[model samples]
Target: MNTMTLWHITPAEFAVLAFAALLVGFSKTAVSGANTVSLAIFAAVLPARESTGVLLPILIVGDVLAVLTYRRHAHWPTLWRLFPAVGAGVVLGTVFLLWADDEIVRTSIGAILLLMAAVTVWRRRTAEKEEDPDEVTTRAGRAKARSYGVLGGFTTMVANAGGPVMSMYLLSAGFRKLGFLGTSAFFFLIVNVSKVPFSAGLGLIDGPSLLLDAALAVFVVPGALLGKWAVNRINQRLFEQLVIAATVVGGVQLLVR
Candidate 1:
């Protein structure tokens, strides 16, 4: 397929998508949940359903970059613990997508984005009140992992919106910056790569979508590099607030549009 002809986006739209792609890379390296904004941008610019498929390849690219940058810090046990529940959630999400139309998908994504932002805020506040925020009892940790894993899987499958959910989980579990980034990198890489066949079966991943992904993929690299440089120097609080604000605006736009 001629990608030039297949992708009917205007120059302005392409600029927007390229910016979103850059955010994807930056989010992977610097802040885990920051890409919720990228999700919103993609859904707004492309057909909401099709956007998820196109975004997936770009995400995998970011995931790979993240793994390369933080591979040694990954927590494999956590990944293994979450995978079974995540798998079950993915199946459930597939069923949901099979039944939902474009409008439904769009609205669901908007709602999920808003919910995730709210959840992230709540998690942070609650963690601050705890005596030992990083220490979870064995049973509690397992239950929490299962809950977050399933939700992460569902959101990722439906809207490519799992970043916030997983972010909250890792933060609650008390991971340092590098460990959080590393575990998340591997988790998304495995999960997103696995979603390819499902997305393809749903007709979300096709020749044209792949073509669009190819065009957007290059932008992710420079963004990743920038994120690596900024990760240590950036003010975390200020950046998170911006990410949340942008996510809120995007979510509201999707809901009301």
Candidate 2:
């Protein structure tokens, strides 16, 4: 693994990785679960752990663009409530990554994505029964927040797969469009940036991965711009359905691949 070099990778593989990186930007700005497609693409084309490492930087780039666009609309109280649990979860995930082999990492990421996709579907189907946003401070609501926060951090660290998990939590908490975008942008920017040290220490992000990231990073700008133009034009129900469908397909592909 240490001897792995970019020279061995085919042109087709580079194209896929570049597309995945572009999708990362579009997902961060326009759609939530869309990057799950990128996650699957990266994992399919690269070593499971290595893909996670490379994808983190690209995700952060997208996160920065999203944050810059939505910086003023964030809801900080929710972030404060979730950070402690997220930190603990990140620690746990780091330990897991250190121990797991390639196949195990692949399967675990697939399972987590599938589970989160289910939750997203169930939440949407039962939206009528969902509680008011004002109840976020209540005991049950706080518990829910912490639980999702932990899962979000853990999944993100392990697979760059936190989008669906956080999407569900925010939707459940009733964040409208701008608030949701702003909060998610800041949350992931902080979360992904905090993870750089852990990934580096683990030797997951190295010379070849960095080179690959640099190439893929350039595609994110156009994707982000496209996303911004398209976000308001799409129907909400259609967006949710597409995200759910992409997530499920990605999860199943990971398991089989």
Candidate 3:
């Protein structure tokens, strides 16, 4: 295990950390995985290496709540189908992180977000009536699924920012509200769970991180409640739009910094 010094975080910094954790909890459960923004905020406010370590445990707590809330709605077939490809991408990402610089990672994430955003716009403009299941399953769906799976896995493993990638895919797939939440919840449960060992191996999980996590757990409750309210009050179209907007902003921030 790598030895790390525990920086003496001030009360103000601890408050910032708690606020970020709150956003993460809300994003995880209510906003369809925009917690990447919270991750970025945490990273910006702390050491990048330590940020990843500190945030993982907080995320797990949020994830448990999300799974509990959305378990019945998951599309297991989609989750299972994406796993092999996503796992491959995760392996590739972990290897890349072993040597890559922060700028490179940030730039890659920005490019991906732009690509996904462009695809989403193009589909919105040109897509005809939704293709029937038979049409979907034949050629286009499989190819799209494979592409999204690979992208999601790589982006998530590297930066915890796969929310936008998967959001675009799920949006284009034309899932209803419940299905979207369910699919996302299940997908991330697996992806995040898989990341634990790799994170540990990469020295992103350690004692100080656990201490930070413990401090932030208290904020998750209010975030979850707020998320519940947001999900119920926001119409589907607006909700999705907000998610896209948040993702775009977060992606741009990552790229710029």
Which tens-of-lDDT digit does each residue in 122-191 have in candidate 1?
8777775532333445788789889989988997898888777787677666666777788999999999
Q: Which digits, one per residue and each the tens of the lDDT, describe model 3 over residues 1-257?
A: 23343466778877887888888778866786477678777878777655766777777777777788878988777777678888888888899889987778888987898789778867867988654323345566788888888989888888877788888887777766667777787788778888999998998887767776787898987887788677878788887787778778777888887
User: How far is 74's C-alpha from truth in model 1 (Å)?
Assistant: 1.1
Candidate 2, residues 1-257, lDDT tens digits: the string is 34364557799898988888889888888887689889888877877778788899899999999998889988888888888888988998999988888788768877887888888677768777756656666888899888988988888888888887787787767676677778989999999999999999988788777887888899998888888888788776666666667677767877888
Among all candidates shown, the one with the greatest lDDT = 2
- Considering summed lDDT, which 10 consecutive residues are worst modelled in model 3? 129-138
Instruction: Name the regions of candidate 3 deviating beyond 4 angstroms.
Output: 1-6, 131-136
Question: In model 3, which residue pairs have backbone atoms overlapping below 3 Å?
Answer: none
| Model 3, TM vs. native | 0.93
| TM-scores for the candidates | 0.87, 0.93, 0.93
Taken over the whole model, the C-alpha lDDT of each candidate is: 0.81, 0.82, 0.78
True-vs-predicted CA distance for residue 26, candidate 3, Å: 1.1
The number of clashing residue pairs in each candidate reads 0, 0, 0
Q: After aligning candidate 1 to the native by TM-score, how far in Å is the CA of 169 from where it should be?
A: 1.2
lDDT for residue 134 in candidate 2, whole number 0-100: 61
